[model samples]
Target: MTKNCFLKESKSFFTLIAVFFSCCLFAQQDDLQSETENEFWRNVQFGGGIGLGFGSGYTDISLAPSAIYNFNKYVAFGVGAQYKYLKQKDYYASHLYGGSLIGLLNPINQIQLSAELEQLRVNVNLDGSNSNSQDYWNTGLFIGAGYRSGNATIGARYNVLNDKNNIYGSAFMPFFRMYF
Candidate 1:
């Protein structure tokens, strides 16, 4: 329910994952004919989202990189890490870092449906205090649908577990997913 969650330590862990995935992304070669066809690697995809917004001394920045394994044309499962920082000049500052499990289904090439469960460690300091003023775990389970194309999906999801200090700020959030 509540505990000391170190932002520094988790930052290191996420950094390591980011490096490993970056390598995988760069290792991809365009000429498949010249290389061995590894079915496992072929069905894997790497991509994520970055968000930044600032206005009138308020700032929000987020990074979420994920990898998914597609079992076939119809099913997929994956994990992702998320980190978001929110700051309002003289109000409060928050750090949210954690991981999620996601499952995807495509009944047809044009439609995608998904279910995602996220567990996050939240830390907030009020009035710019350097100490951790609040620490807690927040959970969200989102069910969504989107329009799917070659490598992208645009959709909105509703968090069934939406509660106090909701992670995405709303019960409904829009998402853009791309895998390459």
Candidate 2:
């Protein structure tokens, strides 16, 4: 009977150890899952920026607001809109309204490369003419690089567009963006 008692005691002790270890492992897994969820939601971000460019016969200033949703650490997609005002050397000022699609190479950490395509409506007033009511559509392609830390991003882009007069040129824009 002594042998039977000893065997029962050893089995109970092993069972208790197994349950304790299993509970610890489960708790660790739960903590890891919660952390991962937090990081995923943190990848969703929003930002805005302003920039200027100077070219022959015109100087341009623009504002853009953007938002992004990151499904993971390495990929993100976003949409944004921009408003641009252009002042020509001897012509009436023009206004442009546009939107873009933004893609990122790496979204959750520091460095990223981006590409964007945008379409705009350009409205211009003819000099000294009552026919200040001309409107046209333009399309732009922009390629850029960026870096992000905390809530701020700084980037530069090369933008090309076809205007109403079939004028095509490249503009450089420096921007600051914030994420919330």
Candidate 3:
């Protein structure tokens, strides 16, 4: 085989191996935490975000729902889904849907660290006689730190892959979380 072909194949092989090992590591760590005193459901939290807005010039709607499992005091994992729609008067409309894999760590009572991997699909259409439509996918990896108080957390995160054309809009974003 050509040298270029061999190199390409090796990269793909290494990526698959890395992903496999990561999955195995997370699974083993979670299993090791099963001995905690709390019941399975007791360690689970459910919450998300909601938004609805309308004006003379625009409309907006959003919904996000998530569930998290606190495997132990230091590690947690979760998943979430999101949907949003926006429209501007006599201009365009957009629809977006996505899901995320979340990981969190709390080393103390007041500080938390988080990571999220998200995959989203977005569709947009212009209005008027010469209208056009486009659909695309966006993936983002965000890392953040936050202050925690009781059941609420507030933080800022930066998306490592954010770009001017990405659905996330900004490389920097703020977040609020609550555990029930």
lDDT of each: 0.90, 0.79, 0.90
State the TM-score for model 2.
0.59
RMSD of 3: 18.5
Going through the candidates in the order shown, the clash numbers are 0, 0, 0
Which model, 1 or 2, shows the larger lDDT?
1
Instruction: Name the regions of candidate 1 deviating beyond 4 angstroms.
Output: 1-37, 128-132
| Top TM-score model | 1
Q: 48-161, model 1: which lDDT tens digit per residue?
A: 899999999999999999999999999999999999999989898989999999999999999999999999999989995677488989999999999999999999999999
lDDT of 3: 0.90
Clashing pairs in 3: none
Indicate the worst ten consecutive residues by lDDT in candidate 1.
28-37
Residue pairs clashing, model 2: none
Task: Work out how many backbone clashes candidate 2 has.
Answer: 0
Q: Over the stretch 1-180, how does candidate 2's per-residue lDDT look in tens digits?
A: 699999999999999999999999999999999999888678778887788899898788988888888767677789999898888887778888889898876644797777888888888876677566589887778787778776676888777553445424436777566757
CA displacement after TM-score superposition, residue 167 of candidate 3 (Å): 1.6
